[model samples]
Target: MKYITKNKKNNKQPRTAGEKKIKTMDPALLQVRPAMQESAGFEATLAFSDMPVHQLLKQNIQNKGYRYPTEIQERAIPALLKGADIIGIAATGTGKTGAFLIPFIEQLLHNKNRTGLVVVPTRELAQQVAEEFKALTTGMKFRAACFIGGTNVNADIARAGAKNHLIIATPGRLLDLVNRKALHLNAIEVLILDEFDRMLDMGFINDVTTIASLTRARRQTLLFSATINASQQTLIRQLVQDPLTINVSSGKSASSTVEQNVLEVAPNENKMEVLFNLLSGDSFEKVMLFAETKRTVDNINKQLARRGVRSDVIHGNKSQHYRTKAIQQFKTGHTRVLIATDVASRGLDVQNVTHVINYQLPQTMEAYIHRIGRTGRAGKKGIAYTFIN
Candidate 1:
């Protein structure tokens, strides 16, 4: 396989005396070449066949019934395995977690005492990543500690102080631990900023920058996001060094498999009535509803319950136990609807979400993409209905 090398002619000059000179590769120029398509109904070509994956991971992949890698996974796994810092841009539900986790765990298994830090924007994402890491590292000696807000800080400190191989955390809690001297980033060999655009949207830039400054300068960094903007590009330039940019999509934020539409409500019409009407229909088997604030999420969940809709709610104000329970109930099919704020937009990975309803549109287009992304996962057809008041 021929790889695209960084263009030396596009290198950017150093801005200051002590600043490191960086590459100026245009994101448009760095695209992942399309791989051979698989025959209809047969397992797709395995991109990892030629890569140096562990025998145990190979068995796990087979056991989990993974036949072919997603486009991002196909391109990213090999580059990450080769120890290249990468900036991966792919839509949600494109198997990004596996793309990064596989190579990360492989490196941990191959090297001794090497620690990896995966910083995400929300607690749900941190937990989801930790679960994926656990699934991949089953029967291995690696230990992962999940540090997020709302959990006991002392317990988190104990876990961080232990001999853990992986640290999956949100920025605020991780920075708190670091400030307390309970967790150190000096030993980190691998650093990943998953859903980084969301981190920027959530106003975590300062904390993320501080945490990155704490880590060793020579570590490998992998940054993944569905969309990259000018501010994000500035951060990428400051963080990663001559990174390989892999873009799988043609810059489409939302998934193509999702049928998106807007339900316009007249001036005098009640938006809740329209929502109730849609919920009464037979088209929805499982649904996710997004609102703009915690109070709005609670009100919607309450209104849905009063109107005989079995639903739950999650938000920043809820305790960790309540949020986890709500997610589990939604995932197990016990609830037909899960109403949430933008907090659920990023990394809530429930399966079979037949419909995603925007009771209110998100503040940013990126959040809308993530909210709709909850559905249409795993190549399944889904619908996204937005209520426009």
Candidate 2:
């Protein structure tokens, strides 16, 4: 890739930096590339049947077409089955959901009445966890309630009263239901916070804490996040007891399979036009454009639509129905591009995404990683570009 700079033009890959503050328009910083390294490794001697889980779970695993356990699943399932508190750090698409679900399902099979709760950062994530739980417990007699915002409160209340073995919920709606006496979590045996750090990022820490406190009988607390900040040390301690930290992705990094680069927007150049020209390329199929705010996403969607490009937008401002429909349209290839704010960074999972473009630089590196991770999933080669204007 070539870059245009104020001083001169070049075709060099920029050196990676360790900046405390981002320098978005630095001419010397032409491209931002992630250092490639093996994520992590473990002895994979056990198959689904070899693990000491129920036969039904083995069958379910096979039915899902999961041939082998990912690193997190392999390391977490054993300890979790023993009812141990754990802090799991793995990248996106590493099977973190299955790691917790498989063991917890085994726990449910042994004792049918015991209930568990999974708290996530987004409504979409809560829905996904519930769906994963359903798939894992296909033949088993397990029941679950999913409570999220942008849905009918009365419906969640009715479902909450139905003797469920598990509850998957987003923190705000979950806590609201608890305060309204619609949901009872006092006797819950296990509590899981998926995308744990993202909850902190979204300012849902207090809500999650209150929900965790309400689940007073939680014997095992499982925390999973793709990236962990050292500043969250105190919060992590409060969540888990004598926790085992598992770093399957080693530390903070983007996917190795993603080809990371940057686009230089010259002082006089029109960035929107530059993006339009880039997307016009034959290689730019099925792209995700990440903008800083809802208004920006919507503007981009409008611009793309006017230029005869099929696209959809999702953000916190959109209702659940709108966001769900937008994602479905993008996922099904009905839309060639999906424009989004940070809300879709964690929970949005679409397969075979050809490219991810950061129209605006993310506030933090962790957010950047989550944004690019939407592509390069399931061991597929993908591309990510950050536009430097």
Give per-residue lDDT, candidate 1, residue 30.
14
Q: Which ten residues in a row have the lowest lDDT in candidate 2?
A: 11-20
Model 2, runs deviating above 4 Å: 1-32, 35-43
lDDT of each: 0.80, 0.83
In the range 1-389, model 2's lDDT, one tens digit per residue, is: 33433322333322223322344434343345454445544557778778998888999999988878888899999999988999999888678899999999999999998889998998878877888889989988789999999999999889988999999998888888888998888999999999999998889878878888899888999999889889889988888879999988854877787777777666666667778878999998899999876777888899889999999998888999998898888889899999988888896778899999998788777888888888887667788888876
Top candidate on TM-score is 2
Going through the candidates in order, what is the number of backbone clashes in each? 0, 0
Off by over 4 Å in 1: 1-44, 47-51, 250-252
Q: Put down candidate 1 lDDT per residue, 322-355, tens digits, no spaces.
A: 9999999999989999999888988888888999
Candidates in order, TM-scores: namely 0.87, 0.90
